[model samples]
Target: MTAVPQPTAALLDGTALARELTARTAESAAELRRRTGTAPCLATVLVGADPASVTYVRMKQNSCAKAGIESRHVALPAEISTAGLVDAVTALSEDPAVHGILLQHPVGAHIDERAAFEAIAPGKDVDGVTTASFAAMSFGLPGFVSCTPGGIMRLLDAYDVELSGRHAVVVGRSPILGKPAGMLLLARDATVTYCHSRTADLRAHLREADLVVAAVGRPRFIRGEDLKPGVVVVDAGYNEGNVGDVDFDSAAARASLITPVPGGVGPMTIAVLLEQTVEAAWRQLVS
Candidate 1:
């Protein structure tokens, strides 16, 4: 008897895709600057000294430099009051020199994250954390998207994963990742189901999903056995030890396409951020 060929999943290769997108963004930035003599500028608001957040902000700044976009950083004390932080962010929102605004997450236990996000002007909300941006993404209007979710969409399109009429399960409901991701997929004509910490029968949802997005911030929480064979997986988790929310090996074995943790969603987030920054600057010139 002839042996059947064993199926192996294809890696989505987000890092390579991200590089392509970033190169395009660089070209766009250069053209925009050449025409108007105004380079796109992104203002980063960091409220604390958390190592991870600090590193992320630095990475974004470095990317901006490479793309010929200027980065202005605003650092606030970790113990600052909510009102103070909001005021600080509001100042950046009102600044004419800034095209995009990014406020790093997990600022402090005492500060209200939503309020800080709201302080960012919707026009400059490149990070897409505000209600205005969320509404735009949900309604299929032209506006900035949540960076990580936006990056995931780019990855999906780059790989040509069909979303129309597909059942997509988003495992998590955070404002930045899960909620926006489901909305984006739904806008593409996919049926989206959102799962959170309190979700019951999570495995049942996985079984029905044609596309699965793991962004619950857990380390390898989703196992391979739960994945429906041939499912497309986008794991957006970046936890301790460079782990992802979905177990990569198991899911990759079962999935037809899956994104790697380190090279996947992480790189795409910065790419989206840079792209939007340039767009925001161009918009201001015409407006």
Candidate 2:
């Protein structure tokens, strides 16, 4: 008798989950509109003319439209000073009409990115990049989370992945994705470990993980050989052409569950953005 090949692991299918979330967000936005006669608005700020950043912002705006949210775009020149960028964001933070503010990352070498992020008021920091947002994430409070991390949590919940006591190793330590992702996992009672470029024997750390999140931004950084069989893998890296950090061809063979690049974490990020915008609007109306 011929030996049969093992079945491939199930795909996490973030696109489907994002669609569901968008529908729910639309309903919430509609209700908010009925109550206050104004829809939630998101101000998207893009510095420099990085094509990738431009495309990402456009995608976000389209998602907002689909979810019944309004988006305002602010494009600043590449040479814009840090102080100028901060002033622009601060203006948006004070704009009563804008419920959320999203400043695209890597705002050019000349700008102080953290300062610009901090300029967004906590109430309107729906992108969750502020110091206040980080504190809220660490404490598991009811506040907007970093979009990609928030989306990863939503994806895991959709697949009914049990997080309690599981060893989740997140490879990366960036404030937005990696660090925040680990904290969210911990919030769900998962035993979380954070690793980065400086981590010694990275493969050893991954081998012990029951769950792995690759957000290092390096294409194919996590190999299948490094993974523990039956592990749940989430690929949140978005490189050129929708490439992921994991070696999907190999990692998929070993993982029990895995998210794809383009259709995976990508769509979910925008979904969370729109959802949070609506939430901000509701809170503003109530308060």
Tell me the lDDT of model 2 at 176. 91
Q: Which ten residues in a row have the lowest lDDT in candidate 2?
A: 2-11
Give the distance in Å from residue 287's predicted Cα in candidate 2 to where it truly belongs: 3.3
lDDT (CA) per prediction:
0.92, 0.91
lDDT by residue for model 2 over 130-249, one digit each (tens)?
989999989978788999999999999999999999999999999999989999998899999999989999999999999999989899889888987899999988777568999887
Per residue, candidate 1 scores C-alpha lDDT tens digits across 100-132 of 999999889889899989999999999999999
Q: What is the Cα-based lDDT of residue 266 in candidate 2?
A: 86
For each candidate, give its TM-score against the true structure: 0.96, 0.96
**What is the clash count for each candidate, in the order shown?**
0, 0
- For each candidate in turn, give its C-alpha RMSD to the true structure in angstroms: 2.8, 2.1
